[model samples]
Target: MQPLLDAILHGGPMARRRAMAKAITLLESTRADHRAQADALLTALLPHTGKAFRLGISGVPGVGKSTFIEALGLYLIAQGHRVAVLAIDPSSSVSGGSILGDKTRMEKLSVHEMAYIRPSPSSGTLGGVAEKTREAMLVCEAAGYDVVIVETVGVGQSETAVAGMTDMFVLLQLPNAGDDLQAIKKGVMELADLVVINKADLDPKAATRAQAQITSSLRLLGLHGNPEHAHHDDTLWHPKVIQISALRGQGIDTFWAEVSEFRRLQTANGRLAARRQQQALAWMWERIDAGLKQAFRQHPQVRRLLPAMEADVAQGRVPASTAARILLAAQFGKAPETIE
Candidate 1:
């Protein structure tokens, strides 16, 4: 155990990666012993964490997300920063795991020495992001990675989950794709810290016009998106929209500059620390919720009561709510109100 701790604390690159991989596997395990070990590892590593910039990127399908991240990651590495990309792919419920094939898409970044790429499956989780993705980010930061990028499954609701975990949420889009005025639904647009219009090199003229149209539409909706920092004195947070061609590596440097500037503003205004604290608290509650669920499943009374409740509902002898109350009473061996 001490050797393992030393490996995690003072290991070289390969050793650090091995420790991180082991730590994540422990985090994902369902065994009680593994949970204890995982908690210990996180406790030891906690102080070494939180230095990396956590950025989340999401978009609709076919928004060239992989390509864009590769371009952006490589650019960051060239600036002498270590980068870690944690991509959460949509999972297959039938398989109970993800294909985790993002490495095939991000070829250049995957091979770069300064970049660490991890492709995690959604694992039937709502966010389509692994439960340990945030923990994984901490491990990477402790291992000396400077930037942590989380890429989420692109559906609107899934993107919201991703947003809660990230410092900056980037929504990517292609010009002229959705509806008239390059229309993205207002619900998704409201979450964007920055928007990127990709595939600009494919059709330059059309892309330019589409960007302008989308910008105009966003402004009309009171978005006025411009990637500005909102401090106590200023509540305006205007998201920035930039045209980029990930495949052609166009505008990536400028886009990264915007990201750096945003981070600087956020850190200066204390938003960065506040956001991290909020994320940590949310993580704690999530663990509590998961623990309660596991406890319910493991309790013998609850397990036995579940089938009986289903039968009562099917027979119309009792409403589902009443059945639920009875099950709760049985599970706790007390009145429902007392249980709560």
Candidate 2:
């Protein structure tokens, strides 16, 4: 563990890549001993974290997410910054594993010395993210990477977990989306900090029309939903839509300029710090719930009683609430409330 940490923090690019991959795997491990070691490693690396911009990028499967991420990553690298890209692929529900094929998609970025690309399986996690992705981001930050991009296999309705953890959320849209609310109808649209209509060069007019329509839709949503952003102050950032050709690399510079502006405004207004604090608290509770669930499932008495109770409930021989009380009693020595 010490050697891995040293290599990650002080070694050459190849060495750091090896060490970083190993470190993230350690964090992703569910073994009790590995979890303990990972917790300690995170504690040691805490001070070195929180220095990067956390960006969440999400779009439909064919929305050119990889193209945009690779281009943006290279652009950031040329500006003398280390960039790390983490792609979350959905796991096969039957096999409980993911294809993890995104690294091959970003061929150039994958080999760049200034960049690190990791493809992580969602492990059946909601939003298609490994529970440890956040830890991996911190590990990258500690390794001096200043930009961490979390890309999701955007599926289903509404926002994924990426929106909750990132400092900024960017939603990619199709060029000819037009005024179709169905494209952004899911609650997910409300979470975007910025919207980009990619493949704009393919149909410039349609792209422009999509941009205006999305902009108007956002304005209406902001009015009805995010009242805080409705009357933006100098420090407040109102979500804006832009057109970009990720493949051609057009508008990359302009997009980054907006990101920089957001960082400045968010920092000056204390929104960034406040948001992190809230996220930290929320993360703690999430972990606590996860830990309790693990304990409940693993407790000897609960384990012994679970099958029969599950069968009884499934067979309609017992009420679910009654079964829940029995499991809780086995673990807690008493139910919180009377069940029957």
Candidate 3:
């Protein structure tokens, strides 16, 4: 563990990349011993983490997310910034497998020495993000990557999950994305720090319309959605809309300019530090919920009763609520009636 930590913190580019991959793999492991070591490694790396900018990007499928990310990543690298991309690939629900083709899609950035791209399988995890993505991002930050980008699975709606973990959440949209009332729905758009219309060169007219429509929708959300999300405060960062052609690399500079501004404003307002604190607390509770669920399932008494409870519920012989209580009682070694 010490050796791996040393390599990650002080090794050459190749060595650091190898160490990051190994560390991330260890973090992703479900083995009991591996988890213990991964926890220790994370504790050791904590001091070195949180220095990088965590940028989360999300959009619907076929929105050219990979194209845009590749463009942005290469641009950042050229500016002397080391970038790390944590791309989440959706796993097959039935087969429990993933293609993990982000490396193939991001051809140029994947091979760049200043860029590190790690494609992780979502594995049925909700929120379009992989379970270990946060851990992997910390690994990249500890390895001295100044910019960390988390690319979600593009599964739409529930994709808002990435926003909670990232410092800045940028939502990518297609030109036609604003053609309906869906744009005003209360979800991902409300959380965007910036909205980008990608592939604008394909249809300038549509892009312009989308730019206007989304800008309006965001304004409405800022006014009516959540008080905390309101952009009316001049002191706080207001979300902006921009058009970009990621395929042709147009507007990449403008996009970065907006990102830089957002970073500056957020940092100055102390929101960046506050947001990270909130994310850390949220992460702790999320892990606790997961741990409790795992322990519940693994409890010997609960395990013995679960199959019967499931059968009863499926057969309509027992209410799910009652069966859950019985299982809880069994796990705690208490009388089932006492639970009710």
TM, every model: 0.85, 0.90, 0.90
Q: Which 10-residue window of candidate 1 scores lowest in summed lDDT?
A: 223-232
**Cα error, candidate 3, residue 177 (Å):** 1.2
The order of the candidates by TM-score, greatest first, is: 3, 2, 1
Q: Cα lDDT for residue 324, model 1?
A: 76
Task: Please give the range of 10 consecutive residues that has the lowest summed lDDT in model 3.
Answer: 91-100
Candidate 3 clashes: the total is 0
Question: Tens digits of per-residue lDDT for model 2 on 62-126?
Answer: 78888898899999999999999885555434433222455566778888999988776446555
lDDT preference between candidates 2 and 3, better one:
3
Top candidate when judged by lDDT against the true structure: 3
lDDT of 2: 0.83
For model 3, how does the per-residue alpha-carbon lDDT over 1-340 read when each residue is reduced to its tens digit?
Answer: 8999999999999999999999988987779999899999999999999999999988766788888888999999989999998865554454342224556768999989888987764455653244588889889999999999987655543455678778999988888887974654457777889999999999999999999988888888787866866635766888889999999999999999988988999999999999999988887888788778889999999888888889999999999899988999988899878996
Clashing pairs in 2: none
Error of model 1, residue 62, in angstroms: 2.8
Candidate 2 versus truth, CA RMSD in Å, comes to: 2.8
The local distance difference test score of each candidate is: 0.75, 0.83, 0.83
